[model samples]
Target chain A: MGSRIEERFSETKAAGRAALVTFVTAGDPNMEDSLALIKALPEAGADLIEIGMPFTDPMADGPAIQASSLRALEAGQNMIKTLAMVKNFREGDSHTPIILMGYYNPIYIYGSQRFLDDAKAVGVDGLIIVDLPPEEDQELCVPALAMEMNFIRLATPTTNEARLEKVLTNTSGFVYYVSITGITGTAKPDPDAVSRRVALIKAKTDLPIAVGFGVKTPEQAKAIADSGADGVVVGSALISVMQGHMKRDGKAASTMVPAVTDLVRSLAGAIVN
Target chain B: MTKSDLNTFRAGPDEQGRFGIFGGRFVAETLMPLILELEQAYEAAKEDPAFEAELENLQTHYTGRPSPLYFAERLTEHFGGSKIYFKRDELNHTGSHKINNCLGQILLAMRMGKTRIIAETGAGQHGVAVATVAARFGLPCVVYMGATDIERQKPNVFRMKLLGAEIVPVTSGTGTLKDAMNEALRDWVAHVEDTFYIIGTVAGPHPYPAMVRDFQSVIGIETREQMMAAEGRLPDTLVACIGGGSNAMGLFHPFLDDKDIEIIGVEAGGKGVETGEHAASLTGGEPGVLHGNRTYLLQDEDGQIIDAHSISAGLDYPGIGPEHSWLHETGRVSYVSATDSEALAAFQLCTRLEGIIPALEPSHALSHVGKIAPTHGPDHLIVMNMCGRGDKDVFAVAAHLGTDIEG
Candidate 1:
């Protein structure tokens, strides 16, 4: 079977527009609501879905995603529950690529081989482990590739030419270009600078390039898409939208799914237009 | 057991910054370039004679090193077994072994032309040490301290402020050492251009564990010479507390090749390990990644980090140095735990007998000494690293013991 990530990018290319990659923490607030949100995402214009396996210490994340993970954990989210949520989402949706993103410890503890088999069985198409750099390929990257799953690599403003080659060696599915040098949702990226870097990376790899980290609003998504990125990824902003609609006790405020889906819809519209 | 034959133990952390499978640069892509540059700069600085001379000069004159190694006669008598010696690192300028690392790192930051310094503190000893050096160098310093630490370690917090360092109170996680470290890492990523992160322990990425160990090894280096001078032979055992395991690493690295010497690292068993309220990473946790390296960490079944609890603020950390993990696996060091009550009793015993009020960190080690010292014969000499002074911990200790202190 072909990779869903490759198929989705190809479909977007035929449509002459960048894919809208939407990210949400699995089991955030609660598992049932999070599964409902995932089921509603594709219909709401998300071309690709990224589910965060909520971790206790998300050092690379900003306040928004960090709090989201904490809420998920407090609501009794674990690896089993997170994978079950993905399996539940796969029941209605079979086409939209689902990418699990987070640190490596959870997977390492869950047993890498078991995690790979379970993820593949549950229709997880790719992974974006933030802490596993290219230097740590032996730990997860090589094994994930062996399972025919895309081990997505992140390239940053600081990833020089020499380092970029190492990053691209085992990376599959797509390359995530973090436009800023800081954590998520903290700063804005310059569209012109991102365009130059995207062109530079495109010159090196044939894979799709998705720009994220600070691409929040519809306007920012359009600016990044116009800069030659194959996909536009938004995470913290979507999480913030859900957080804004959350009640005082951290339960979803009835419109939480709609608030997230509405933002994804706007971002998708901007990328396609 | 000679220094020439010590190559096997000394030549660790190969070119990849790993002590076996423990240490590596497990960080995001955004910080990769900065860590690589730091590695290069550290390599050059390690070889430069000028850097050596400068660090030596500061160690001797500024920080007052070659700290005296004193024999605890009364304590040894009370135990009625092994003779005990104290490696007096607490007598240093900042009242701890933390200054040893801060001075070396600050010099490197100066050589690299970094304008700002950022650090993470657990018990606030490292914060004061970093703030002290930053003040001396006339550089702006930002210290991320957990709010829980700020409340318990108020004296050290005030010292950092008096030294003109800005304290960023972290309320994340359990509001302690682990949370403070997370905030510092986030700050380092944002200010990578002009900022230099002085990690206070033998943890973090490659150069940090190796580099900080190199700086703090003065404790072991001096202890070896002092023990030989005092007894005309090497001590049979070594003991020190392990939080991030800096002071213990400092005291253990030089003697790693000496196969006859027994090394013990004491961890804080808050209430007890069985109660699940402890900072005994090697004793209670499994190997995992946090801060920057893969080491033994207190984490849940799902790999989410668990908050560590300890009466001593400095020992309340969830992870240990990667080198310690490698050493524990290699059977070079035996890791054990001392309960909060045990350490408190040891603290009072040492103050009454030795007239030296030891910090709660080393009191954990002292508690272990109380156990093993009585089991050994008189010919066995034990060297314990008195890593910090206890003045900063007076308020916390009083509160824990329920002593009503009159103003």
Candidate 2:
């Protein structure tokens, strides 16, 4: 079984700091650089990592992440390369958990059983596939759990109490609560309102809740922690930083990895009590 | 109608929505909450006089419904068959039956207080229809199209853009209609609140198939009256192509009570059914669940859906609508296949013989007319629902045949 997400939550809580979840596109720029960032993330103070398994179309993601996915795909990244990258991550850092987030079709194309076996073998801790809804858990969730890998559910602000309960019931790993009603990178979430909702979900679920989809900065992360969230997930903001660094003419990109990691590091410190 | 007559044709899925062994609410547990809400809202809307009045008004005003039942004299004579009548759905504001459902769904979206309309399209017909309604209601519209389809159907892409809809070309999973659907569903998951997913066909979770079918059934409702008035008898045969089977089922539904009528659904046979290249779900597929309902699917032995191929993009789906599956199993409608060669022949036949170019999707049905007309003879009247004109397919068809479509 892969390392449990709760293990990190407990560690972060004992240290009096909210868990810092950083998202990076798996093959962004290329596999080599992405692997470096994946290893660098934990050292840079990110308590957890959400590794984007770049699908050709990442519909739920906003411009930054989507563009990064395009760049990754153009650089010849697929599920095979993505899993290989995770395998590399496992070689060095065994404590930090990695979640593979993307759509379902790639998994469907790659045999579900084969994928589960491969993901588990590579030390992938979980998945946050936007397209694989709770109804579709039979396709991958069972196998993922059987292989001891978590299959995280992306819960939204509009996910009502009843729907939230159902999502929570089926969910295996931590729940990534989207703070806003809009697409990723689009909404500027009201932290107080998001926290109240998170608190309600927390009441319903004994599982850890890592709020995502708009928690983009140190301030937002600190606010989410204050509001009773176990973890604060930041994705688009770091992507925006990386994208801003890379020139679009499609040449080699130097590692803004250090600069982006600096931002996540600052957020991680802010989340520390 | 007599009890004996009602026995001739089958309606339903009776009210509770059961179509023989197929179709019952086989939705995901999460959507159950939303589905219940929709069912209640639809029930109230169905009974409200204001709802019907508003729909009737819009159908008349915006869509120009009650389109002419065009009698194809030249083509009928050349084919030497029973007289053929075209339901001029092509005359509807968007030049297809798609708008009929779009207007209704867009209105429902408005009533539900949604500020955004989202849809996935295969051939761009549904995208155009949804965009048209979005413009009329002044809602922000977003369309998801497979990157491949976006490149193929460029004109329709421009049409949607001109109508003020944002087009997001989906670049995943073979980038076809199915991929577009996956992306659209993902969009709905993120923006479920204030967004009404305007599904293009009679597919998706429960209420959508039934709802879209109901809206499109106006095609049959109009054709039935027109044919009855003109021929003084119902058609001996009713034929239309099936993709998600919306257009076919729409025209066939109202005629279900008429025992004298024989119904046929033409599926795309890319090369030929015998060559293991076809979309003839009832003929070749096994029963399986896909796109939210249990239906006949063209899946491999491993239960993986095989990619379907067709000269016509609209008719190349790997599965049939659950209701159509029910109709096929119960022998209410005969499902058949038409090859690329056959459909192309029919496309050329219609243009040369009748001066009306039918879309490749409906031309599958058009090709079947030759086989059936000879068996039934000229005395037996067959009314084929010519669902669309051949504009979008002209480029694809012409390039295949090595002939340029003259302006």
Candidate 3:
């Protein structure tokens, strides 16, 4: 069977619009609320879901996603619990593609083959390991592909024509095009510049290009969608909203889920329109 | 390990920068071109005699190279077994061996036409070293340090500021060396064009571990010559404290081919490994990735990088150099750890017996000497790298010893 990532992009293509990819740390606030939030994402208009695997040192992330990971880890989130959340989400919504995104250390420690097997068993369609570049593809990317999992690769502003060949060699599913040179949530990408890069990347690969990092609001999502991206991803802004709704005691306030879903709805609506 | 593998140990990193599946360019794509550019620049610099001459000139006239390999008469007498020698790198101009690598990297930064320098520091020795070089070369420098480190290593913090370097205090992920490094990498990613990152240790990406080790191998090079001149032979054992394993790798890389000499790397056992509060990556951690290199890292079962604990800020890092990991796996180097109390006692012992105030980083190595020295015969010679001076560590050590000093 082909990946749900491919299936989702095909559906979005049929709808003549970009997919809305929503990101959330798997156990942010707590596991129960996190599961509830993810289950609500698809109906609220998220075409694809990216679940963050919380790590202590998220070097590529900005402050907001970093805080989200810490919150998840502080609430006792681990690979087991993260997968369990995916399993739970898959039970109700098998059509929505769920991508696990984070660093590679946890999966390296968890055993790559075992992680791929368990992740596939729990219906995790793709992975976006932030720290694993194409040079170190043998570590996990090759094994992940052998397991028929979509090993998504990231394309950035610094990825030259020669290097792009290496990056796309074993990559399947969608290509994540980082809009800015800095870490997540640091700076906004100019739509004209991002559009040029997205067009260049589309010329090189058949995989759908998803633009992320620094796209914060509905307008930003609309701009990225207009830039020829197949999907528009918003992470730090959503996490920031949830953070704002958190109580002083660190528990999620009653508005946490609604606040997050409302933002996702707005972003999705922007792209759909 | 086989003889072929042992013979090939010196030839590693192999184009893509893997120390047998350890070090690689595991950075974001935005940093890939910069890393590759750095790799090319470093390779070219390695072959250029003028680059070597300039670096040597800086080492000799500026950083005070060939730091003496002095025999510790009292400590050796007290140990009653091996004759202990101190590779007095603490006598270097910046008060640590960190300057050795900084001088080399700064020259490269200039050669590459980069106008700004960035670095990360734990105990602040590396920060001070980078800051000093930045000042000397008239380049703008920024040092990323944990807020806790800035508070604890006030002297070095003041020194960096005095050198006219900007200090960015990082308050993320337990606010230590690893966090500081993350922040620095983020800064490098943001300012890749005009900035050159002088990584403090033999960690991070590929060219860094190899390049930093190349720069630091001067320690081993000097030690080899001095030991041969003094005793007409190599030392039986070599010991060095490891945070990111730069100093240890500096002293170990040159001697890796010598099958007869034993190498030991001491890691910080903050309270003790049993207490789950230590920076002993090889001793207590599993193989994982952090910063950039895949090495022995202190991480939870689910792969979250765990905060490392140590009384010494320099050794309080959760990951080690990938070369150290490869050496450990190959059984070329034996790794051990020493507790905070043990290191404190060793610090006091070295100060009293040797009349030298040793940094807490090297005190971990000295602690191991106390244990291993008694077992070996007097004919055995042990050289331990005194990587830093204790001046910057006085306040921390004083507080640890429960002594109050009013400034």
Candidate 4:
């Protein structure tokens, strides 16, 4: 039984377009609105979903996503709530791939083996731990692959050919090629440069390449998808829109879910066109 | 934990940078290559005599090395028990031991051909040190200081500006040392090409914890020699305050092999350890990963990092150096804490008794010294690290004491 992530990529490839990967911090704003947003994602056109487990310190993320994680934590998000969000989403939709993404401290605190067990039980398809490079594979990656779960490693502009070999060693599912050298949501990546880098990584691995980090607009996502990426991941852009609709009292301002889903639909339409 | 031919405490952080499952290069892929490059450059620097000679010359003339290890005659008479000695590192250039590590790192940054230097500072002592070194070396320096720290450490902030270093105030996560570090890491991630991050503490990633410790180890090496010249033997006990454990690690690393010498690291206990408002990571925290390495961190059960509180800004961090975690776990070093009130009392006591105003960072150690000194007999000798001067902390201390000095 192939994982849901691999199946999604294969299906997207069969449809002759790149997959639209969307990310949102679980429990952002609040749990009720968060669950509603997650359930609404698939129909609005996200082929793959990445739920960020809120951490107090998110060194890799830029301001937009950092603020989003802070919002989630302020609303009392934890590892259990993050996993439960996935479980809630799974009850309605089991076909769309769900990946948990964040730093390793929360999971390390949750116990890696136990987190994997609970995550797998709740239908979490993959993981994208930002801090755990290939060097510290024994901590989570190797064990994750052993359980037949996908451990997606991020390849950046700094990841040279020699380092790329190490990065792709135990990596499963797909490769997240960070388009820029900086943190998430900061600088816009040049599509030409990103395409070439993705092609270079593609020469080495059979796994699909999903270009992220500064990918926001439908036009930008379409441009990267047209240039040969198998997937386009949008995060900070979506979170920025969600931030606009959040009330000062920390409640969703009613336009939160619709506004985000509308943006996702446009991005999906651009990718799947 | 005793040093033997077969088992030396010095040989640690094996090839993968693991100090017995404590420290590792827990960073993003973008930082891995840069970390490896730094490790290579440092390895070569260690082997080259030219590097050693240059560092020595700077330490001697620039930083004024061989910092006097003074006998605290009055404190000894007052306590009337053990003979106390203070490793007077506060007399160095920039009025703190922070210059020792900054000089070594600025030289390394030059060797790496990095044009821009960035650092994160808490109380601004490390910021001043980095800024001073950058001025000497003619490199453009940027120091990330938390907004709260900038407000509290206005004098040090001005010192950095005077030294021609740009100070960026970080307002994230309570606007303290941890936030500044997070901001600096984010800056490093963006500008990885020609920028070198000069981490001020014995924390962060692999080479940093080990490298900063080596640079700051001059304190211990000199203390060993100075004690030998003064008393013809090693001291009975060694003590230093820990803020990310750099100054303490500097004094303790060289003595880890001495079976008879007891090493105590004093952490900042805000109100008290039980109040859940302290920065005593070893005493009140558990092992967790933050700022690129695994160490004892003040975190909740759900692993969210808790904000640390302490009277001393330098000691207000939630995490500690990874090497300290290893040393604590191995029972090679004893970790204790001093409360804000205790350290404040020690600050005034040292100033009045010895006529030497020690920084609040070292005051934490001095407070611990007051407790343990009277417990020992006259033959018992104790050495505590006076890592910095209290000039920068005077305003904050005055405010706390309700002196109401008008600016």
Top-scoring candidate (TM-score):
4
TM-score of each: 0.98, 0.76, 0.98, 0.99
lDDT of 1 by residue, B1-407 (tens): 23343456778798889988899989887787888899999999999999999999999999999999999999999999999999999999999999999999999999999999999998999999999999999999999999989998888999999999999999987788888998999988888899999999999988899999999999999999999999999999999999999999999999998988999999999999999999999999999988789999999999989999999999999999999998888888899999999999999999999999999999999999999999999999999999999999888889888897745
Better of 3 and 4 by DockQ: 4
Candidate lDDT scores, in order, read: 0.93, 0.79, 0.92, 0.93
TM-score of chain B of 4: 0.98
Task: Kindly list the per-residue Cα lDDT of model 3 for residues B1-407, writing each as its tens digit.
Answer: 64455555688888888887788888877788899899999999999999999999989999888899999999999989999999999999999999999999999999999999999999999999999999999999999999998998999999999999999999987888999999999998888889999998999988899999999999999999999999999999999999998999999889998988999999999999999999999999998888888889998878888889999999999999999998888888899999999999999999999999999999999999999999999899999999998998888888988889864
lDDT per residue for candidate 4 within A98-189, as digits (tens), equals 99999999999999999999999999999999999988999999999999999999999999999999999989999999999889998998
User: Worst 10-residue stretch by lDDT in candidate 4 chain B?
Assistant: B1-10
lDDT score, residue B135, model 4? 96
Please compute DockQ, using alpha carbons, for every candidate against the native two-chain complex.
0.78, 0.12, 0.79, 0.87
Tell me which residue pairs clash in candidate 1: none
Recovered share of real interface contacts in candidate 3: 0.82
DockQ score of the complex predicted as candidate 2: 0.12
**Residues A1-273 of candidate 1: C-alpha lDDT, one tens digit per residue:** 569999999999999999999999998988888888889999999999999999888888899899889999999999999999888888988899999999988998899899999999998999999989988888889999998999999999888888899999999999999999788887999999999999999999999999998889999999999999999999999998888887877678889888889888899889889
For this target, which candidate reaches the highest DockQ against the unseen true structure?
A: 4
Query: Which model is ahead, 1 or 2, in terms of DockQ?
Result: 1
Cα error, residue B160 of model 4, in Å, equals 0.3
List the RMSD of every prediction in angstroms: 1.9, 6.0, 1.4, 1.2
